[model samples]
Target chain A: MQASLFVSCIVDQFFPEVGESTVRVLRRLGVDVDFPPGQTCCGQPAFNSGFWNEAKPLARRLLRQLEGKEHVVVPSGSCASMLRVFYAELLRDEPAALHAAKELAPRVYELSEFIVDVLKVTDASEIGGRPRREPEKVTYHEGCHLRRELGAVTQARALIGSAPGAELVEMEQPDVCCGFGGLFSVKYPDISGAMLADKIDDIRRTGAGAVAACDSSCLMQIGGGLRAQGLPIRTVHLAQLLDEAATPG
Target chain B: MEATTKQFTQSAAKTLSDARIQDSLRGLYGGFSKARERAAEATPGWEEMRTRAQAVKSHTIANLDYYLEQVEARVTESGGNVFFAQDGEAASRYILDLAERESVKRVIKGKSMLSEEMDLNRLLAGAGVEVTETDLGEYLIQLAGDTPYHIIAPAIHMSKNRAAELLHRGVGAEGREWDTAELTAEARRQLRDKFIEADMGITGANFVVAETGTLVLVTNEGNGRMCTSMPRIHVAVMGMEKVAPTLEDMSMFLRLLTRSATGQRLSAYVTTVDGPRGPGDEDGPEQFHLVVVDNGRSRILADPHMREALNCIRCGACLNACPVYRKVGGHAYGWVYSGPIGAIVTPMLTNLPDSRDLPYASSLCGACREACPVRIDIPRMLLHLRRELAEGRNKNAPVAEAALMKVWRLSVSNSGTLAAANLIGRALRWPLLLLGRLLPPFSRWARYRELPRPVSPFRSRWKDIFRT
Candidate 1:
């Protein structure tokens, strides 16, 4: 089966390796993947900022680029949710595009959503370094958009559990937002930091070696605080782990 | 004062950081959040009730003008005077003139955010009218000379120990370590004399029923009833948006409000009073006046994205469910109305420059939407306000932020560059990784969190597998 891989802009610009890991993991599962070069963003920032007028053109352009695709997958839950929910709202004035938006939404899936529901690959990946360190106990911070909006929490954890030596532990209110709403961070830094501080404390309380989430933006925000404190705790996108699991040690 | 969003937030930040106030807000966030969650679970049709309640509020707000007239006519016929004050100054002036005419020197008040918005206590105090707050929370906050942090629980930021100290100092009973009951007794002993001696008692109405010309006041404390009935002259200051189309509509809201607010089957007191006391009535006000203050609601009513905010029941359920509020608490909002409703109202009611900063206070997590009884799309409103801030609609935001968003808006609109960047992202993976470590903001991002490192070219691998 052919799949269109959407390396969400956040992953593409800052964390290109996530894009590579997604492709490797998908290919290992025998899924044919194509990175549609025409894709840039899902137009979430504009849509979330209430610039429906500005976001609509981008949404239309996005819909047009991936128009004929049967399966489109993204590593980020928020970008997927934008396509699932806000894309249609943005294009409301253009009734002609409604069919395209509706048709594209269900077919648009997050990484775990695609792997578990579509690919159904449930084995561990034999990655490099002879396990590197000890069997690391990691907890997942379920990004709000992915968990609450996209309902990708369980699916994300299931994929994590498929990795060898990666014991996925559940953090309390794993779905609570880590205060990274794109512009919300810079706009209200104090409140954002305060909220992130709470999330970090919750993650630390679980005594997990690292925090993993599907959205790079959320990871970036949570990771910033954890890194600032110089804690042993690290943050990674789930795609990286699953890709590592797929490789031979 | 034309309070812009900036001033509101600055003041709020100052208040939130105050050690004494922050200590009090700990209970406000924890206690209410736990209580509301438990209440929702116990109520069988909690979700259904919320849906129905939202529908009712939406319908009333949509046809607000008709309901306002209906309520006015009913109140007048019931022997009560209904005055529509276009704004706060007008509302305060009307109340002050009424008091002057009635020779009212002493005034008592029940918990009312609307009165606080109008600064009625200050206005009445300036006129040499001694006004006393009847609710225990309101009384403490009043003595402290501060505005309420939370809408429902006025002194929610106050600790019992702090309250004991504030009361001991205010009432001239120095050095007395008072318990909760003792604190209540002190408030009662002091307010009792004012409640009886005062010529007028001012209270805020929970809802104004258009069908029966009735004003309902729901409270855990019985002070609302006493303040309304004990005085010879009664004046209820309510925001114009508080009107419901009918008694049934009022009933639907009351159930959702209390359950969502404090996890109670019903508040301890729900009093519905219409007009003056009848000849046979035992104890009630003889002259009743209801001042409907618009303040800035009419402007909010004009904005399609924001008008639903006026439907808020002042139930702080959204506050309890909000993660942001839980962390910083209500004082962070820096207004009489805090939590999700404050995020919407403070900016809408105040000018864009001063109050708009309050809207950016949320993470737009939509928890407020789930907890809202009227189902006010608070996250949506916050986003809209954010847009306004981004677009330079807010008079208070820094010019630098606006310029940056303009650049951001321009860059995202074009696909060719964005696509090129997408491909470049796969190509320049090494340098970008270095950039993430070296850059100031990126360093900030990496400090608490880690961005995933992409292994190889997503586009080229896909091309080899799919298109080939």
Candidate 2:
């Protein structure tokens, strides 16, 4: 089955490596992936901030861009949740857009959900290679929209557990938000920083070498906090981990 | 209490920096949530119970006028009087006038958020009538001359040492180190005398049963029973939305209310006061009054989008579940009610201009909605409030933020503009890296966390690396 990539704007502009790894992982799974060049964003930044009018045009553009694709995979859980859950509500007033959104929403999937649920690929060896180095201990941070909205809690963990050289060390309160709620990080930096402090402390207790999450926004927030505190915990995307496990160095 | 919601940002910053509040919150962060989870798990058909409770609230709110009239008629038939107060000032005035006419010198109060909303204690005290808070938490905060820091646990921000100090000052207790049991006994001893001397007692209704003409109050401390029974005159004040059509509906709500509020199947005392003492009754209030305070609830009930807020049972499960509330504590919200419910209700009940920042205080995490027993979509209402503020409904909208959103709308509307902006971002990546730490917008974000530098745009780099 052919799939279209919905590389989120944050991944496109701030973390291209995540997008590249997503494509590589999908290709290695023997699923034909196409990059829909017309994709810009899922309009979450606008929609989430209560700018439905501002978000509508982008939602329509996204619907039109991936209209006929059988599967639309996204690396960011927040963006995927926007397309899969919020698009219909955002365009509820316009009949045509609403109908298109209803049709398109169910087909969009977050990267881990796409791989485990749609592609049915879990074994690291089935996709490609063995571990090139020692197994790295890693913990997972469940993005709020991804875990709570999309119900993709176990899918990412399953993918990580199945990867060749990654050890999944569960952190406390894995389901708590990472406080990188897009504008929330900038709007209430004190509260956001406090929440991140709690999250980083939890990560420290696990003593994981790295932290992986499905959403780049969360990784960016977590990574930024870790760097600010001069902590050595590396932050990575789940796609990069899965790709790294599947490909030889 | 005067509203500090307008200064939510400053107050919230101060609350966040306060080590005492932080320590208090850390102790309370997940205790309620975990207990609630266990309680819900223990109860069979918990989800179904929540659904049924929501349905009951929706039905009652849809026919609120009819239910409230029924409550008044039934209450009057039971030899009780019912008064409708349009707002907080009206409610306080009516209660104070009653106190004056009845020559009530001492008044004892059970824990009542409605009383706090109406600022009734101060009004009564200003009228030269002695008033005492009977609930342990409320009494401690009263002695400390501070407002309640939480709805369920009023003195949650205070430590045992603080309580001991307050007791020593207020009730002339021996200056001795006290534990929880001893402090509670001292509070009981002090309040017990006030309860006997009190000529009038005031309490808030958890649910006002329309069919049975009953006021249902759930409390663990037994102060509710004391306030309702000991005084010659009894007054129960509640928001008009508290009326339930029947005792059966009240049962459904009772099932969820205590579980959500305190993670218990039932509170220690569930007092249902039907009316004044009957012909054969041994002990009860001689005169009963039910003051149903509308207090901007009618306005909220009229709007289709905001009507769901009236469905709140005020159990405060939302506050316990909110990460934001857990951090800043209740004082940051700057009102009687705090957390997600306060964020929505404060602005709607008062004026949006005064509480404009309250709605934006949340991260929109939806934890509050998940915890709400009635399933009030709090985040949805918060977003609605935000939209109203942005669309010029309130004059307090920040100009810079509005302009920034407008520019953002323009940039994200089309792929071409976004691509151009991405190109500019790439070209200025190094400069942003150097100056980002010192810039205005980045400075705000960098105050607590580092900003991620922009990498090569995917459009430009994907072709070279991945496409080949």
Candidate 3:
């Protein structure tokens, strides 16, 4: 099965390794991954900033890029949700673009959702490589759109749960937003920081060696906090986790 | 009640800096939010109930004129006067006029956000009526001369010690380290006499059942019962959108609202007040008046994108679930409502220009939507309001932000411009943060957390990675 990778702009610029990891994981799962290098963004920032009109041109552009793809896998849940939910809302008045959005939305899937649900990779051992001497204890952060928008809570957990090389531990209120609400981080840093502190508290209490998440936007916020506070815990994309497990290191 | 929504950020900073308010606000998540989660989890068909409630609200709001007319006719038929106030001022004026005409000496009240919207207590007290809030939380805040920090728990920001102090200073309580029980008892003692001596009892409606013009109130303290019964005159001030078509519709709402608000299978009191005391009635007011306030609801209803916000049942679930609300608490929103619902309603019901920051306060996390019993898409409405503000509906819309968005539109509208921007972004070590940290708003981003380290654009390396 072939799937086109909609490498989100965040992953494209700030974290290229996550894009590589996503590609590695997808290829290992026997899904032929293709990239449309022309892809720029899902227009979430402008869309989320309430500049729907400004978001429209980019959204229209992205729609044309993703046209005719069988399954479009995005590395970020917020971006995926932007394409699936906000795109339609933004482009509602434009008949052709809105029609394109409607067609593309059903095919759009977040990485983990595409992996477990679409690719049918139920157990992680199938892709997990060498068993670790010490199982990597990892906690997961549920991105708002990943869980709430896509409702794919179990897919990522299922993969991590069944992995032979990793142990999946739960954190309190993992589904709560990490406060990287696009421009919100910039506009109201104090409230966002306060929320991030709470989230970090939960992650710390879990005593996990690493935090895993499907969306890089969440990782940017989570990982940023973890680093600023000089915490030892590492942050990884689920694709990286899956790819590392599948690699015989 | 004035729109200090512009001060949301400053007020949020105040809440953040205060250790006590922070501690008090934490209960929203662990206490009320957890309880609501458990109740919904335990109840079968909870989702179905929410969907049904949304459907009911949608139909009711779409035909609000019809239902409201039915309410007026039925209320009149049952010997209750129905007055539709165009806004809070109109509502307050009508209510004050009635209080004046009746020569009301003392007035008792149940908890009502609508009353806060009307600024009723202050207005009535200014008119020389001794207005007393009967709900424990409302009474505490009333005594403290404080605005409500929450929708259901009006005095949620206050601690037991604060309550103790308020009771001592305001009502001559003799104790200091009073616990919740003692504080509640003290509140009851203070309000009990006012209930009987009051010439009028004014309350807010949870649902105004249009079929019979019945006002259903759900409360834990039974204050609703007293406020609707003992006084010679009973007056209910409600937002016009609070109407339900029938008792059955009200029942569905009751099932979801109490659970969503306080995690109760049922509130301690589910008081439904019809017009007034019948000839054979053992208890109830002799005269009843229903004051339906528009208060910019018609304006919100006028927008198709925003009308869903009218579905809110005032359960406060959205507040409990909102991460932003949990941090800033209610006072930050600077209005009767706070949290997610407050963010939307305050801007719409009041001035969007002054409350511009209110809509943008959230991270657009969608938690409020999940927590809503009627399933109000708060984030959606917030986005619409944001769009309205961004489109310069609000006079305070920043030209700089508008210009930046325009620049952003030019950049990402195509792959070519995007690549060029990414090239600059990549070479500049440019996560935008490195440059943004030099700026004001973006400066806040780096204060609490480090921005991501720079990396090469994925597009530049994708071809090389793909060949492998």
Candidate 4:
């Protein structure tokens, strides 16, 4: 089955490697993937900041781009949530936009969700007939939008647990927000820093070599914090880890 | 007591840096939240109970006028007086006038958040009526000349040593090394005399039963019972939305309230005061008064978007679950109500412009919604308030923000403009990184975390793969 990849704006601009890994993982799993070139952002920043008027056009633009794709996959949970959960609410006044959003929502899926639910692949052996090389230790950070909004809690965890040689060390409150709430970190730096401090401390206690999350936004925040502290821990997107496992080098 | 909500940012900064407050907050975070989770797990059909409570509150709020009139009629028929006050100042004045008319010299109070909302103690004391707080937590904070740091646990921000010091200074205790038992006994000993000597008693109602004209109060301390029973004149103040149509509805709320607030099956005391002492009653107040204060709640009730906030039972569950409140503590909210409930209610009930920052304080984590007993959509309401601020409906909207959002909308709407911006961003990554350190706007982001450098845009990398 052919699917359209919704590479989020953050991954498009800041972390293209995550986008590349997402494409490789989807292609290797025997699903035809296409990038809808007209796609940009899901209008979360404007919508979340209470600028519904400004966000509507961006939502409409996305609906226009992804218009007839049977399956749409997003690597970022926040952007996927914007399309699947918020678009209809954001365009309630306009009938056509609302209808398009409603129609497109069921087709939208986060990356791990698409892998586990659609492709029925969980571990490395299930993909491309290869055993995986796993790091010494890894933990998963559940993004807020993925876990709470889309209810994608167990899919990513299941994949992480089944990675060949990696030991899954569960951090304390893995579902707690990573404090990279888009504009929140920029607006309230001190409070954002305080929350990230706690999150980093929790991650350190797990003694994991790397942390994995579904969304690139969370990885960037977690990676930035780890790098700033001079910690050697690595941050990997779930798609990147799955790709690493599926195509062992 | 004063409205410092306008200074939320400054106070939050101060609160974050204060080590003692953070320590007390850490202790509170574990104690209250875990107990609540355990209580919810142990209770069968807790979710069903919450739904029923929400329905009851919705029905009552929708028919508030009918139930309020029913309440007034029943109380009047039962030989009790009812007063309606439009705002906090009016409510305080009405109580002060009543106190002066009745020649009340001393007054004792139970733990009443409504009284706090009205700044009643300061008003009453300024009017020369000596008001004594009877609840243990309330009494300690009162002695320390501080407001409540929490709804259920008012002095949760204070340490045991701090409490001992406050008591030693206020009540003339012997020394500072007082244990919990010693402090409790001392507070009880000191408050016992005031409870008896006070000419009037004042308390807040958890729910007002309209059908039976009964006022229900749930408190962990027995002082709620004493505040209603010991004095000659008894007055219970409540928000206009606190009425329940029947005792059956009251029971459902009672089940949800205690479990949500303190994770108890029931509080230590559930006092039901119907009216003054009847002809054959042995011990109770002679005169009973019920003051229903609007104080901007009616305005909130009138607005369909915000009417859900009135369904709040003041359980403080949302506060314990809120991550922002966990970090900044209650005092940073800078109002009577703190945490999620405070964030919504303070601005809506008071000046929205002054308290605009309260709604933006949250990360919209949805934890408050999961924890609310009546299912109040606090984040949605916060967003609504943010929209109001953004649209310049409230005078506090920053013009530069609106313009920036407009520019962002224009930039992101077209794929070409977005791609061009990304191309520029990728090309200038190194120079921009250097400039980011010197600029204040970018420096804020770089203060605690490294900024991610822009990579080749996805459109450039994906052209080869999709070309085939």
Candidate 5:
């Protein structure tokens, strides 16, 4: 099977390791991974910020980039949702972009979803992850768009739960947002910070070695908070957590 | 009563600093939210029920004028007065004029958010009528001189000791230590008298069944019934959109309402008042006046995008489900309604330009949409309000923001512009980290999280990185 990577603008620019892990995991599963060059952002930040007009062009660009790919894997849930769910809404006025988005949506997948649903890799070890030197604790933070928009609630957890190298601590309200809501984190910093504090507290209570999630934006938020709190916990993407770089054994 | 929604950020900041309120707010998830989840899970075909209810509400709202006229005819036939109040002032005028004519000196209330919307208590007191809030939560908050911290749990932000202190001070009780039970008992005792002595009772309508001309109030406390049955004159005010087409439709609404509001199969009292005392009625109010309030609802109903907001049952399931509401609590919303619903309702009902910050208060996490029984897409409404703000359809359209978003639009209009922008971003990344802390909006983000340094744009390294 072939999967064209849509390295969402965040994974593309700020978190290349996440993109690398995603590619490696797909490759290890005997699925050919291809990076479509013209791919840029799925235009979520603007789309979410109510600048749908600003977002529509980017959505058009992406739909053009992956019009006929067999599978388009996005590392970020928010970006994937933009392609899979919101692109149609953003491009409804333009008949051509709208049609292309509708055609391309079923092909688009968040990484964990592609692995579990499309690739049918139920266990982490099947995709290059081996038992670690010691068991590491990892809790999954369900990204809102990933869990709610894509409705892939248990795929990430199932993969993590089945990882022999790691123990899933299952933090309280794992589905709660980490409050890195694009411009929201900046717009309402106090409320965002308070929510982030609660999320950090939940992660701390689990005593997890790392917090795993599909989207880099959430990982960035959690990772930054952990670093700020002077905690040693790692924030691993679902792809990174399943990759050999994070696999100890 | 006055719209202070403009102070949302400052109020939210204040709420965040207060540890006590924060601790209290945290309980909403476990107490109300989880219970709602359990109730929905336990119910058979909860999703289908929500869908069916949404369809009924949508139909009822679309043909609201027809149902409303049906209601007016039936109500008038039953010898009850029906007043179409254009706004809060009109509602107040009708009620106050009725109060003067009836020589009403005491007024008792059921838990009515519309009462808050109308500023009824202050206006009545100013008219020299003794107005007492009959709902325990409403009474305590009124006594403490605080607005509702929540729709259902009016005093949720107030600690037990604080509630006791305020109640003792306001109720003119002897200063002493009090627990929840004793304080509740005292409030009951005080309000019990007001219910009996009151000449007029004012309540909010939960749902008005048009087929039967029935006005309903769903309350956990029995005060709603007391207010309805005990007074000589009973007045119910409601937003014009809350009409259920039939008693069967109302039953479906009842099923959705209690479960959504407090996770109960049924509240303690479901008081359905059809009209004033009938010819042979044993015990009920002598006179009934149904004041149907518009208060900007017509404007909302005309707008296709925002009309869904009127479908809100005021169940407050959205408030419990909101992360932003959980953090900031109700007062920060700066209006009668709060949380995700308030964010849209306040701006539209009051004035968008006045309550501009309310729309921007959320992270658009969408928990509210999931929790809404009628499925009001709150995030979509917020986004619409944001777009309106961005467009500056109203006078105060933050023009500065338009310039920045335009630049952002230009930068990411295509792959090449974005890549070029990325180059510029890389050069300025470090400077952003430093200057970001000093700036207004960037500082909001950088103050909390350590900004990641920009790496080489992925396209720049794609060929080398992808080669095996």
Candidate 6:
């Protein structure tokens, strides 16, 4: 099965490995991972900043890149959901794009969603981890975009459980936002910090060796908070974890 | 009068950051938030009810013109005068004209955000009429010479001490600092005289049911009843979207409104007045008038992404759940309505440039989404408004934020450049930490907290670490 990659702007620029891990995981699952180089942002920064006009052009560009695709998989649920749920809302006036968005939407899937739904991979071919390392307790942080927007919480948990030798521990309010809402962290750091503090505290209480999430933006935040507090917990993106689990054992 | 959102937010942030102000706001927000959580948990099928409430609102707003016309006809048939105001100026003019016709020297008012949007107090006061806010929270803030910081609790930003001081100044009765009860009594005494002598009374409606031509008001204080009934002339100002399709819908909303707003089974009073006095109604106003103000709602409705904002019940559960609101408080929103709902409503209701900063004031936490009984997709709307602001549709964002975002768009749009930038960003983390601590923009973020350094760049460190 062929699938086009929608490397979220954040992963495209700042964390290419997330994109790499995404590609590796898809390819390992017997899916032909195509990097549609023309892909850009999901236009959330513009949309979140209230620049629908500025975002509209970008949305058109993104829609143009992946039109008529059988499957378009995005690493970040929020960005993917932006195209799925809000593109039509944003481009409501432009009926052609709106129609295109609607056609493209049902096919667009978050990573876990594609893994479980489209790729239908029950087991991932992991490369590196064969002999299980010391079993580590890890907790999952459900990014609001994934849980609320994509409604992929159950799918994410299923993917996590599918990983080899990884114990899935639930933290409190896993769906709570880590408060790193793109520019929001920079704009309202005090409140953002307070919210992150609570999130890191929740992870610490779980005694997790790592905090896992799909979106790199949230990983940056939860990881940042864990580091700031000098907490021992490591932060891992779900793609990287799934990549670890997909190691050719 | 032409307060841009930036100017409003700055002033509001100033108020929020004040040590004394936060002290008061902390108590206000914390109590309401706790109460709301308990209430939400206690109510079975609360979440379902919220969704249903939102459905009703969405259905109502989709057919707003029809529902409003139904309300207008009903109100007219009930012997009440209905005036449709195109904007704030028109609404104020019509209300002011009523005051003039009544020779109103004073007007007793209930807590009405619509009036605040109209700046009715200032307008009426400027016209040489005394407009006394009778709700305790509103009265306290009025005496403090400020607008409400919260929709339900207007004086949510005021401490007991500040309330005492405002009461002392307004009442001119000196005594040892008194408790809340004593202070409330003083306000009651001061406002009671105005209620009796006022030539006119003005209110903001919670829901105007088309079936009955009835304006529903939910207030914890008995003050709204007095303001509605005591005067010879009563005028109710409402946003055009405040109309419900039917009384049955009003029943569902009233149940949802109070529960979501103050965590009350119902407010102390839920007054539904239909026009003026009936045959046996001796104390009711002789003349009742309903002024429906469109302001910018027509524009909002024309644009489908924004029209859902018109469905707001003004319960303020969204505000209470908003983390940004918890930090900055309502005053920081720089508009009459503050919080998630306010961010969406303010820009649409007022001139665009004036409320640009409002949409950015949130963390988009979605807590507000959870709290909203009518289930306004506030985070979605915030993003919508943010898009509007970024496209230079707003006049308020600083040149620097705009420029920075432009550069951000450029760099993030490309893979190779962004990857290189990320490497440099990873390398400069140490220096950026120092710069963030010392510089202007970064200093703002670093001021209250410590910056967390990046672990090695995700790409550079990926292979060996992941072992995949």
Give the candidate number with the greatest TM-score.
Answer: 3
lDDT of 3: 0.87
What would the TM-scores of all predictions be?
0.88, 0.96, 0.97, 0.96, 0.96, 0.82
Off by over 4 Å in 3: A132-134, B170-176, B392-396, B430-435
Candidate 5 lDDT over residue span B273-321, tens digit each: 9898988899899999999999889889998989999899999999999
Task: Put down candidate 1 lDDT per residue, B59-145, tens digits, no spaces.
Answer: 888998999999899999988999999999999999999999999999989999888788889889999999999899889998887
lDDT of 4 by residue, B318-382 (tens): 88888788788889888899998898889888878889888888877777887898989887788
Candidate 3, residues B1-468, lDDT tens digits: the string is: 666887888899999999988888887888999999999999999999899889999999999999999999999999899999998999999988988898889999988999888888888878888888888888889878899998898888887888888876745544545779887787788777888799999999999999998899999989888989999999999999999999999999999998999899999999988799989989889999999999999988998998998988999999999999999999999998999999988878888888889989999889999999988888888888888887645545588887887887777766788777766765676646667777777677887788765566777788776855
Highest DockQ: give the candidate number.
3
Higher-ranked by TM-score: 3 or 6: 3
The C-alpha lDDT values of all candidates are: 0.78, 0.86, 0.87, 0.86, 0.86, 0.78
If you assessed candidate 5 against the hidden native complex, which CAPRI class would it receive?
medium
Please identify model 4 stretches exceeding 4 Å from their true place. Answer: A120-125, B170-177
The fnat scores of all predictions, in order, read 0.42, 0.48, 0.79, 0.57, 0.58, 0.35
lDDT of 2 by residue, B216-263 (tens): 999999999999999999999999999889899899899899999889
B-chain TM-score, candidate 1: 0.88
* Per-residue lDDT of model 1, residues A72-156, tens digit only: 9999988988888766666766887878999899899998888888877545442222343347788998877786577665787
- lDDT score for residue A240 of model 5: 78
TM-score of chain A of each: 0.94, 0.98, 0.97, 0.97, 0.96, 0.94
Q: How accurate locally is residue B141 in candidate 1, as Cα lDDT from 0 to 100?
A: 92
Off by over 4 Å in 2: A121-126, B170-177
- Superposed on all Cα atoms, the candidates' RMSDs to the truth, in angstroms, are 4.0, 2.0, 1.8, 2.0, 2.0, 4.8
**What shift in Å separates residue B289 of candidate 5 from its native position after superposition?**
1.1
Task: Provide the TM-score of chain B versus the true chain B for each model in turn.
Answer: 0.88, 0.96, 0.95, 0.96, 0.96, 0.91
Report the lDDT tens digits of candidate 2 across residue range A111-164.
Answer: 999988988876655768666646899999998888767878898898888788
Model 4 clashing residue pairs (backbone) = none
